[model samples]
Target chain A: EPEVTQTPSHQVTQMGQEVILRCVPISNHLYFYWYRQILGQKVEFLVSFYNNEISEKSEIFDDQFSVERPDGSNFTLKIRSTKLEDSAMYFCASNQGHFGEAFFGQGTRLTVV
Target chain B: AQSVTQPDIHITVSEGASLELRCNYSYGATPYLFWYVQSPGQGLQLLLKYFSGDTLVQGIKGFEAEFKRSQSSFNLRKPSVHWSDAAEYFCAVGDGGGGADGLTFGKGTHLIIQP
Candidate 1:
């Protein structure tokens, strides 16, 4: 079965530095999303992208966060300034249509120091 | 607002034993419910979902869930579990009639399959 894929399985960055997490959603999927899981915490939704624009976002997705589908296949989340609290496992997901079941990627572990 | 609740934080059961994970939700309208599993260092994998139709929904890997509208719950159950079933399970709720922007997830219940 085709699945979502994320790059840089693990990353370490300094505080105040910029970081970009990349994801390649399933080729035929139309809705894409980003979620984060702090260590020992529940997964939290960050943002959702569809039709080349953001559909909705959570409070955690503040000014520092931005998502771009620079190309047809790649969905990228950039944090203008990384903070210690930003460290977590980021997962990318995609669904075929509205309210459809979603498939998720393995996730990228971001570590800020 | 939509929200999910998984009451048990962690549960341990011997291999071959039956298992059930409880989940409850708070939604003003009909809710789309889902169960997902995550192994250590891995991403979340959809276990099953309930939208409309039968109250009971079967899913991959020998798992199933019952949607009880009266109780506002969707609980996951398996007749028999294997050692590999050890993982963290999460329950999520979404607005059934609205767009996909309204999913809220519970913390999760860790399952430990003992040998």
Candidate 2:
């Protein structure tokens, strides 16, 4: 089955450094999303993208965070200045259409020191 | 706002025993409910989803869930569970559709299978 794929299975960066997490959604998918789960916490939605732009975002998706569909197949999340609290497992997902079943990537574990 | 609650933090069941995981949802309108399983250090794998129609929905791996509107609950059940079933299960709720459909997930229920 086709699946979403994320790069950098694990990443460790300094607290003040910038980091980029990349994802390649399913080819036919129209909607893409970014979610993060802190250790022992629930998965939280960060942002949703469609038509190459952000469609919705949560309060946790603040100024330090940004997402882009840099290419037709590549979706990325960039953190301008990572904080220690930013450490989490970040997952990328995509679906073909509205409310469709979404497939998730293995996730990128981002650890900020 | 939409939210999901998985009451049990952990559940232990013997292999070959029946299993059930509880989930409750809070949403203003018709909510899209989903069940996902996550093995340690793995990604979220969808088990099943309840959008509309029949309240009882069957999922992969012999798992099924019943959506009870009156109770605002969607509970997952399996007639027989295997040792591989040991994992963390999450219940999630989403909005109608489109790009606005960001899923709200519960804290998750960790399932432990006794051999």
Counted clashes in each candidate structure = 0, 0
Per-residue lDDT over B27-111 for candidate 1, one digit per residue giving the tens place of the 0 to 100 score: 9887888999999878889999888999999999999999998898899999999999999999998764224474678999999
Which candidate gets the maximum DockQ versus the true structure?
2
**Residues B5-98 of candidate 2: C-alpha lDDT, one tens digit per residue:** 9999999999999999999999999988999999987788999998889999999999999999999999999999999999999999988553
Candidate 1 lDDT for residue A65: 99
- Cα RMSD to the true fold for all candidates: 1.3, 1.0
For candidate 1, please provide the TM-score of chain A on its own: 0.98
Candidate 1 lDDT, A1-113, residue by residue in tens: 78899999999999999999999999998888999989888889899888999998999999999999998999999999999999999998888886678888999999999
Query: Clash pairs of candidate 1?
Result: none
| Candidate 2 Cα misplacement greater than 4 A, ranges | none
Which one wins on TM-score? 2
Q: What is candidate 1's DockQ?
A: 0.56
Report the error of model 2 at residue A102, Å.
1.0
